[model samples]
Target: MRYEKIKTLSELKNIIKGLRAKNKRIVFTNGCFELLHAGHASYLQKARAMGDILVVGLNSDSSVRKIKGGPRPVTKEKDRAKVLSLLWCVDFITIFSSTTPFNLLKAVRPDVLVKGGDWKVKDIVGSDLVTSYGGKVKSLPYLKGYSTTGLIKKINLLTPRRCAVRTYAAGKKGNTL
Candidate 1:
């Protein structure tokens, strides 16, 4: 079934409610998704396989900054959501400004809550709520050697540094020596 991507919380809630009423198996996962990578795609696909509908809670730019620190989320929240929407496995996308997806997860109340293996089952937010209702929580294995932080670090290393320009300037200071 074709799912409309929703940005607002109210719209998402309404859609989720309707889907639930029809007894659709909802699968939920949340992340900053600062950079689109193969790992992300694979993880999302695996999570989607767990249920009929896959709802992705994308962290807003502000939330990314808070969780990932400054100079992070190379892509804005809207752009991140756009990238996620392009994936066939992604059924719905919602940009949440909260640092944690707890509130969003609680509202969705999915039948299955999934996260990457990096996260311990005990650490997954909203696990309690889902499990209390006989829902399942899963932590899928992460793809090795693929991460936003690692990607950023690699890019930084490959790019020429400003210190190289600074070294040239330092040699000409006051025309001494």
Candidate 2:
């Protein structure tokens, strides 16, 4: 079945409500997903297995910048959303600007909220909200050493190192060298 992509909060809410009325199980997961890696694919597959529908919340460009600092999310938001929207395990993708998935959680009210094993259940975003709504929160085992940050660090290490020259300008404004 061809799934539709939801761009606005209102549309997403409507879709979720409609799905719920049809008794469709909804699962949600959120992340930056700068570079879609093996771990991401597997995690998503697992998440989809736990429910009838899977919705991915992608952090907006500004949100990525705010949390990951500049030079982050090498992929633009449009590209990221497009890529995620095409994933086999993902039924829908939504872009959000919040630092956390709190607002989106309140709106979608997914039947299942999923995260990587790295987070304690209590600390995971949307955990409380899902539980409060009588929905379940789950964690998928993280495929270690398969994250975007780790990939970036590996790239940096593989590149040639530059020496920091310690030449003293020695208060050169006053010519104290």
Candidate 3:
């Protein structure tokens, strides 16, 4: 499936309204999605099941760095978006630099909002927005041991941490990270 891109608020708002008119239910999901994993695929697939179209709000590179800290976002935003775009479940992709997807949510006002079960419904950023618009929010259970953080951490384990191995104080004899 081809991926539609949402660049500006106006375009997103129009897209939602247009799709809605065609009796299409849109499902909205947002996250850093730093490193795609089984959990991500499962969550996305479930989100897709909730609506006729799945619009994913991906964090911009800077936003990912800000939320995840430096050395994060193993993949660049473009590459990440491209990867998701190729997925059969994702119909549209929007890259946002905001910490929360509030603005994007308000603009899209999707028929359904989906997130992993780890987050409480009330804790979700756009839950209220969707609810206000008579939309629904659903959470899908995550796959065990499948997470972007866990994936990155596992990769980190394979690659040793860089260190200077400096002598601590003069008499210290233990090496530490």
Candidate 4:
């Protein structure tokens, strides 16, 4: 089940240790993932292809608010994690409340650290730490025209305006309906 894929940091650390012992390559990626989309799935699948396991570090609700400001993360952290857990390409998920995944990266010490093409390898957090340990850091290509913000804007545009609501109410003649 999807719930089984969610793990605490300590639990994930132990699991990573075991996987490493088995010579499994671990790939790590971090994101808010406020809303799952085709782009997210494609990127995750590509990241997983680079290693045996894919560990996604999800930003907590508060962390998302800090980075994206208010009214963001359309979904809560737990919900976001649950959604990511359902993806076949994602092996495990760990929620992090920090502004960045630098600490989480230290814990997992993934064989490969990846971010979207929007981020340069040198600018990606934990790039140095991962590279210092002989681990590879990658910048995956970012899919165009697919983003939570864009989706939200589209939804907003499709919604009826307040003037339309007022017109409908006037037609009701004070009826409860």
TM-score of each: 0.86, 0.84, 0.83, 0.89
Q: Per-residue lDDT for 169 in model 1? A: 56
Poorest lDDT segment (10 consecutive residues) of candidate 3: 158-167
User: Mind giving the per-residue lDDT tens digits that candidate 1 earns over 14-116?
Assistant: 9989998898999999998888999999999999999899999999999888888978889988788888888999989999998988889888889999999
lDDT of 4 by residue, 66-133 (tens): 99997887899999999998889999999999999999999999999999998999999999999999
What are the clash counts of all predictions, listed in order?
Answer: 0, 0, 0, 0
Give the better candidate number (2 or 3) by lDDT: 2
Q: What would the per-residue lDDT of candidate 3 be over residues 1-177, giving only the tens digit for each residue?
A: 544564456676777788888999999999988788778888899899998999999999998888989787889998888888878999888889898889888878888988888988898888888898699988778888887777777767763345435456667876554
What lDDT tens digits, residue by residue, belong to model 2 across residues 1-177?
A: 333574677888888888999999999999999998999999999999999999889999999999999798799988888878788889889999999999999988889999998888889997988999799999888988798888888777752335334444754442221
CA shift of 128, model 2, Å: 1.3
Clashing pairs in 3: none
Full-model lDDT for every candidate: 0.87, 0.86, 0.83, 0.92
Indicate the worst ten consecutive residues by lDDT in candidate 2: 159-168
> Model 4, stretches more than 4 Å misplaced?
161-177
Better of 1 and 2 by TM-score: 1
